[model samples]
Target: TLAPSAAPAASASPAPSTTASPAPTQATDPAAAAAAPPASVVAQYTALTCAPSDVRRSAASTDKAQDWIAACDRDGTTKYLLMPASVVGTDVKTASAGLQGGGGTTSINTGQWVVNVEFTGSGQGKFTRLTEQTIGKQVAIVLDGVVQSAPQTNERIAGTAQISGSFNQSDAEDLSNVLRYGALPLAFERSQAESISPTLGRDSLHGGLLAGGIGLLLVIAYSFLYYRAMGIVVVASLVVSGGIIYASVVLLGSAIGFTLTLAGIAGLIVSIGVTADSFVVYFERIKDEVQAGRTVRVAADRAWPAARRTMLAADTVSFLAAAVLYVLSIGSVRGFAFTLGLSTLSDVLIMFIFTRPLVALLVRRRLFSVSRFSGLSPKMIGGRAAAVPVATTRARLAKRPTPAGQKRES
Candidate 1:
């Protein structure tokens, strides 16, 4: 049957143009899990089905099936790498053709959960043929060797194919994300591996969080010591940023099944320096204007243009690098990139919502501008000094220049 040739997903990026398959990082969604089968339960099943063992394929497991096969799910259960036995070892011609996302939606009204897939001309034709041959057979829809869905074809699917099973909204979305893009592994081979764990041990998690806490404290202390009163704003902004990050982490964990790992913690800790740098950029700009004799408020106003641009430029670079890293790297590395990118965004938010506004308020206060501990004082910033006058020399010194045209003194 000519079906969508299951080829390796694009490892570099989540194609913006279409729902191309991605080696996506999946987290469990509570709502979806509650509505459907617990994702963990589903994962365990995939692991066993795809995992390789000493036993060879029998009537149930085809002879061509190898011991080692990876599935398409990112939820950490990869037992069988379903490359559409029909499309295995074959090339899929990717096109700008009629293929597009169905804007899929999940429905449970029929008593069975279903995710309706959208396809174009070639896809529709191939899907129809596939359904015909695989009648009463399960066909695996996999991404990056992880299976997203394996549906039994009951009849010749003429118009559209709906993956019906333990799918909830989140599960449907995950499957849709892969199908919308395209995750087809053209070839399947045997490779040995034990199993995959989605999280680190408790001890590892504690150690990572402890290390990150220490780093953040050190940064806060440094900010206080150097910037004085202004440092309060710095620290406050950071605390607020931390709160936001924490909330997001928790929310995302619940929504998408994301869990914090040691690598992700490290990414957050590293972002401390990056966030702190934003404070310095703004503060230093204020100092420069103060040194030039501008009032603190005026300095703040003037400094914003330059400081905002600089901070944005630097943060943009960090965010882009993190995004690239997230796309290219998997597992822990991708986790790190995810956190780093998240923190970069938080840094931007804190700057606008907290830091800048607080700074504006502080600069308006008399004590803030002139306090000894304040980083904004003219003396502290090395204010511009007035020029000193020089006295003219005596007539005796002027007489020495009279012989310029005469013979040299011996």
Candidate 2:
């Protein structure tokens, strides 16, 4: 009963087609999409090359907090500079990265790969404000005519930060050293850069890593030999410590631009001993307590308080030394200080939170102390088993040679 008029009407009606609709649905404004950053700004700088970590402030006794000035360059051209004055001191603290300049400044014979700078005291507040003000704005960090970092701040930065990009050892060190001496009066005369082969640097890095690896292995082996069963706890603590440190490094890199250098690796290597030293101290305390007639479990529990004190004392000193070094030094030295401090913190965490608890748990197992293979034996630890002395054994050791000639008649 299909009518001709009904068939035509059905054909004219809109159909869900295999393709998209003819008319555009909710058209987006081209300008709006372009208004905000489409992708992350940090990622953009990930491949940046020769970028300087120098953050400039205005000149001395100037009225404006930030000022723009034109200065002469070696190429006989003018370049703009944005230098901010120091808020607290006469001179703003910049990294001493070791640059080539005369006037009491020693030339760095070797190039530095990376330099890290942090804002301390009121500088922290100033840096936070600068990042906030520059949000969504292109802020160019330049050294001479070279653009170091030109990124748009996405959010308000409340803490210190690291400048990122591809930087050679010389460029970074030169920039850091320049910043340390305060902004150039006008412009820097560009000098011919002496090219250094990356191969040499790579070789040095390989050597440093090999040494660190060997040291770590030795420490682990020594712990096993001396501490016996408890060495397992020490190894576990070290593993946990390393994991935490790695996590911290990654997080810091993403969050604040912290970079690990060869010096930083050395700092980490040094921490292996520091971390193991804590275990040795704790285990020795426990053994002493065991020798005083205490059970393995009881000794572990009682010795912890004293062990905790010693660990805290030693680690505190280390942390303090690292802090002072960070404050007083610049460039890669600061990186070393930072890693050292971070490792100390990790050591404390492993010792109290993980190591102590793990030992306590292990000792609680009934078979742990009873098994001769466990090495928690009273004889092994020289404990008070009321051990009787052997006359034969004592006599041999106690008997001294009668004098050179008299002793010949053995």
Candidate 3:
């Protein structure tokens, strides 16, 4: 019981009411009771509505909300995440396996995300832990903030790791550059895009071919005129070297999508001069030895070391130039540098393999030693030294019998 002005306490005893609602024990007005509930009760009710589990359940009903939650949950701690099956496709396993093995290294440094990856001892342990922790989760290899790979781990990995996707040589090289050097090593930015007409490229190619053909003709003519019979060997060596280079180009084009751009063609054209220079060096050295009174075979042998040194020196300069150009230049200039470097290497190979051997074989023959047709013949080489006479003075005098009287007086 309470005074009239004071609020009545809540009744301990449960009681039935005329209305269907629970009986109100307080002495407050029915309207006032309906208008407000106790603060504690209201707080409890609000908290139930805002529980973490309930919010998640509500979010699960909408696709966008679910995605938001999923993304938010990824803190790089989870080993793997589910991605669209279509994005990963069937080749995912194979590629992922390849990534587990170490691949070869390269020099081109684009610097996107090159990491020094190894499977040796400590590396193996780290990779194994990474694979275990990230199992069935996505580990993204990001380059320049773009996801280069978001590979889902199917199993724990151990030992060496290789990064594999649908990568071209350039892509692999670029990635390797990144892993080896770092993201900003190259510092490349898209400068500008200008449309190049194929018409100009075609015209340049045509002119280049024409010039190459004329140069080839001049070399062939000079070889035949100067080297005579031995010139055939020189021509043959050139043909073989050309065939090898052409086949290599075609194979590289097919296998690696290496394009024969105009600049590349120019490099090949320049290589022709390098190759010719090698031949000239060897030929001149041999002729010099022959002029120094050595037999043809001996001259060929004695001249080789000096000629080889000269050829190597010349090719070294060309190779160095090509390498520098490749390192310094970009775009089409790189193609030119690559081709020039390849040709210089081929020149060295041809000098050692075909040219030297063919000359050695040719000089070994009797006809080559004796005939004027052979450019290496001692008599034919500069006409400087006369051939040694076989007949003796006594034999000549006996044949003449110049005087029986002169003999008797003697």
Count of steric clashes across candidates, in order: 31, 7, 16
Per-model root-mean-square deviation over C-alphas:
19.6, 26.9, 22.6
Over 1-410, each residue of candidate 2 has an lDDT whose tens digit, in order, gives: 00000010111112111010000001112232223322332233232222122112211123222322221122222122322321212222455332223211346523323334444566556545555444443333333333232333456655434333344656656545543443444434568878899898788789888998899889878877876667788778888998999999999999999988889998998888889889888888887777776788998999999999999999999999999999999999998999999999999988878999999999988755655545565777654362534566344556665776564564
What is candidate 1's lDDT per residue for 114-225, written digit by digit as tens? 4555456665555555555545444555444444444545676666555555555565565555565554444466798677564547778889889988988898788878
lDDT, model 3: 0.55
lDDT of each: 0.61, 0.56, 0.55
Arrange candidates by TM-score, descending: 2, 1, 3
Q: Which stretch of 10 consecutive residues in model 2 shows the poorest summed lDDT?
A: 1-10
**TM values, all candidates:** 0.48, 0.48, 0.47
Query: Order of candidates by lDDT, top first?
Result: 1, 2, 3
Residue 60 error, candidate 2, Å:
26
lDDT of 1: 0.61
Model 2: colliding residue pairs: 48-166, 56-84, 57-83, 57-84, 58-83, 58-84, 58-85
